[model samples]
Target: MRFLCILVVLFVGLKAFSQDSVSVPSIDTTQHTKDTLTIIGVGDIMMGTNFPEDKLPPNDGDFLLKDVESVLKSADVTFGNLEGTLLDSGGIPKKCNDPKVCYAFRTPARYVKNLINAGFDMMSLANNHAGDMGDEGRKSSMATLESAGIVHAGQMSQKTAIFEKEGIRYGLAAFAPNSNCVPLNDLQGAVQIVKELADTCDIVIVSFHGGAEGAQYQNVPRTNEIFHGENRGDVYKFSHTLIDAGADIIFGHGPHVTRAVEVYNNRFIAYSLGNFCTYRGISVNGVNGLAPIIKVFTDKQGNFFKAEITPTYQTYATGVRIDMQKQVIKKIQELTKKDFPESKTQIDDNGLITYLAQ
Candidate 1:
């Protein structure tokens, strides 16, 4: 009995020693790094001019974004310029004394779902046509977007839009040379607003609807552009100044054509993304129809690492479609090279954007 007792004690001690000696592997927390955020941006979008039923797109807007929905959805955030008001028909239209020189776009409020379905996270309501039906129209449009859970900025009263995604906060401010919107000409005011937003957010994006319009206005003039006796802000100075003031990305649209892409101090600037989708009252011929979906990749701090350009176009009466001809891509490449000859950014034939070797 004594021998059996001593043997049991020895066995228990050995089992306890074996369990205590077992080693567990250490976890590598660094290997689980977060992914870089992707932002996709486009130019003006007008689903259809709803004032007249004939101006609306075919199929009751069922096929408005059939082809490019996937492209827009692939990014973490998608944005565009809301070129018109979302209001019910019947509001007094802004007087366009000369139809040839002026145009107004009013989309039905019900169609706001289309923008939401297209995966647009935000929009810049700072363009000339946002007030097509005046203040009532603008307010209705804002309410519609709010109801649809879409963020918007550009109005002087609501100059900044703040949101968060994936633990990083984003600030968006829009400026344009128009009434009821943040004035693009007020560089100091714009800078102050951007700086304040930057101080609070992890990323800041500044959008401006400046420069001239139409196909002839494709080039970035680097000076103040004048259209119809109105002083459009100097886009080149505005972009650079905003970046210096703490904006990570600058998206410029007003010229209904794609312009150069520049990288200034690790920040990306798309001078003009061009007209993405327009139903009626707008022309979509030649370069005017070239719509580019600019995909931007940035670090947590909002420093641009690379970008991609997917060329798209709008057909008469139809919505946006991907352009296989690569005309828009080639045009932007040419413009970037011509406009910023010393730019370190490179746009390849495949629409891939990367920084050239130092």
Candidate 2:
């Protein structure tokens, strides 16, 4: 009897201990795993010109982005500066007194599908060309992008575009010196908008189409740049201020050439991506031809982890093609070194980017 009672007590004690162990919460390692996201950005993209049929590309815009489509698709978000309006027809063109200097770009509304196929999730409509055809053109462009489910921002009235992917919310705001878009000169206003976006979303991306134009403008000037008597924003000041205002990434374009990449306060900034795919009415020579697609990886809170630059080139009347020599990466490296000698970001010959220990 005594032996049987002892066995029962031992079994009861073991059972209680097993229940207690099971009731204790197990460490949830899954919740602690790092969450990351990838964002890719490119510069000006005008698939084809619609003002004159002859200006359009050969394949009805079919092959415009074929070469870089897959690379663009491989990101959580792909963005570009939609340098022109999307209108099928019927809008009065902007009056330009100088026929030699004035150029306008209008892409057919049907070509929006090509952008979708290219895997573009967002765009900036703040370039000088956005108003080439007036408010009607801008309205048509906005409608077309909306129908295609692509998020866009840059208009003065609509300064921010918020989107969500994979349960993460992202906010984007674009600034430019042109009319009908968020003014790049209003630094205080721009910072306020960015701060509001940062408060509302998990990540905030600030884009600006500022700085001088052409190959001579390859270097980032610390002061306000003036091209053709227009005051392009002080890009160095603008980018750093936006980062201070809580922007995770800053993508700058409008200078028709690639510029330096800097890490300011642990955020990534590409001063200029150059002309990615401008089919007509744009120069594509020397440094102007260099196109870069920058891919950035960041943690859930938008801390930069690493980056990669896939160099591309665009010749006259041709779309963007991958550069085997990685010329754009090399150019960026040189400019980064010259413009920001104390930068923590490192760019290798192979286009890989890393940060040094603080």
Candidate 3:
């Protein structure tokens, strides 16, 4: 097994777990003596939802991440937001305020194999659609990822995840503004989780589903963002505080568009990674299709060393494809320059990231 996953008991309809820390038993997991480690993080992923209809891809959706499998596998740890539920059938779709705007994704259970093939080690389950099938769906999703040996945390049930991969222990915590998820607005709670993880693992990473949605909300407001009457939480303050609390990396999503990238206190943060493999229900028009993979190289102490941004895009028919134009890369550069001009990190045309000269 690539991970030593914990057995978390989560009952259907149960709220978020009250505890922030989980104990890890020591093991001889370090097989490599590398000083540097690479981690790749992507945005939302709903491989193929079959809730309202049968929109599964050709060949059972196994080919969704095949094109970029090698790139994804190149990292020591690969992370993505696992949107929606993973179940063949059962569980009721949550009712939406408006039928026209309601979207609930129900991906097949066997599709976890595709993620394994693509080298996904960790997944975040604290997004809006996480409760698409209500609590039952959430439990099923957690169970599926566990069965696949993929470490996941975001719900109150499992707010933190610790696993050993490549001989290094990784701790991840996820947050969202939605109910049942680790509240993104709860900054203190989030800090406690990160602090605990940092104390236990070699690398501590945080995943958040915050900020407003669509292309217009791409910029981090640096303050609390209210979207559609819902407080999306100020991603800027939240990220910085987590970093201060000992988070090594912060990966933000939910804007459905790529946002800025920054290196704060030598820790890397991607405001929003945009949609990765969302198919059918989610729109892929214009910039929404830009699915750039964030590949960060960090030292053993979890300090940011450098990074690369591999630009890619997604299609409703297919899944993910290489973007030769590097449109997302350019978009990130433009956004980062505009959103965080003071950021020490610089992006080159070839998608390399480095610090500016002193």
Candidate 4:
């Protein structure tokens, strides 16, 4: 038997960032060749910043994500966290309290093609660096993604992203505790946005850049996280509430470390995916480099199905590559069991994620 693979050339975004960027369409009840639909998601991806100077990936950023392209494209939809602004040049960098510790990310605009080549269907622009270059940087990043035909959400100007792929309509509502982004602290606001998407789209995938930072904060505190005098919001409550409000999958990041995953009400929630292709401005040492490419298989109605983990990692020199040791899988398994002891999902040593009924 043969099956056709449909690709939606969805160049969806707003010319001018606003609250009404991409509108949600009517519900689509279409299904493809199989009962399960694959949605691949990864953590923060900065590629390389040009802010405080040129720090592009090896060979000027051409071979950044090539090694993992095949795995990324294997899903019906692919997503990542766009950690910084995409612009060739000029923009007002945000003022930092201490310039000694501040880092601004401004990747070359041309590098957007790298994401397209890597099969990134969507991205989350709700991280701390979203306003690195101020308004100009944000606009450039939005326009860059639009030109690449990739959907992005999380910015206040573009709260939710709606696109169709393989006959299934997908909705993405992103949030963060940063400025210019849809505030993650507002639970009702997120619920409202996700509910709207759920009312219209077949699958609603939520992206959030919350939780505290660093390796020490790897564990889910299950309460409002405070880091350096900043309230990072309670990711535990946020994920569960959004899932209850119609979010099919919630991909969390911002801690710069891989966190536990939970299966709530038959929906998938990866607490944090960690750094994927971060070249500079942050450390990829140890757990920080654990980039788990999560391929979530969901039923036609977005109900949770078996998933797989393609463990991958990156460094300042090598970019993203498949991890032969499956370090990410091992780490996730350990973290998940420790954090969500009652979770119905079990991950095997071989990286297969299955739902177990009580």
Write candidate 3's Cα lDDT for 139-191 as tens digits: 89988887777878898888887766656778899999998899999898888
Task: Please rank every candidate by lDDT, starting with the best.
Answer: 3, 4, 2, 1
Question: Model 3, residue 141: displacement in angstroms?
Answer: 0.6
Give each model's whole-structure lDDT.
0.82, 0.83, 0.86, 0.85
Task: Give the C-alpha miss distance for residue 7 in model 3, angstroms.
Answer: 17
Give the runs in model 1 whose Cα sits over 4 Å from its true position. Answer: 1-33
Off by over 4 Å in 2: 1-34, 97-99, 316-318
Candidate 1 residue lDDT tens string, 291-331:
78999999977888899998898886567888899889999
Report the lDDT of model 3 for residue 281: 88
Q: What local lDDT does model 2 show for residue 278? A: 87
Q: Which stretch of 10 consecutive residues in model 2 shows the poorest summed lDDT?
A: 19-28
TM-score of each: 0.89, 0.89, 0.92, 0.92
Clashing pairs in 3: 16-156, 17-156
Candidate 4, residues 247-318: lDDT per residue as tens digits? 999999999999988888899999999998888887899989887999999987899988899999887767
TM-score of 2: 0.89
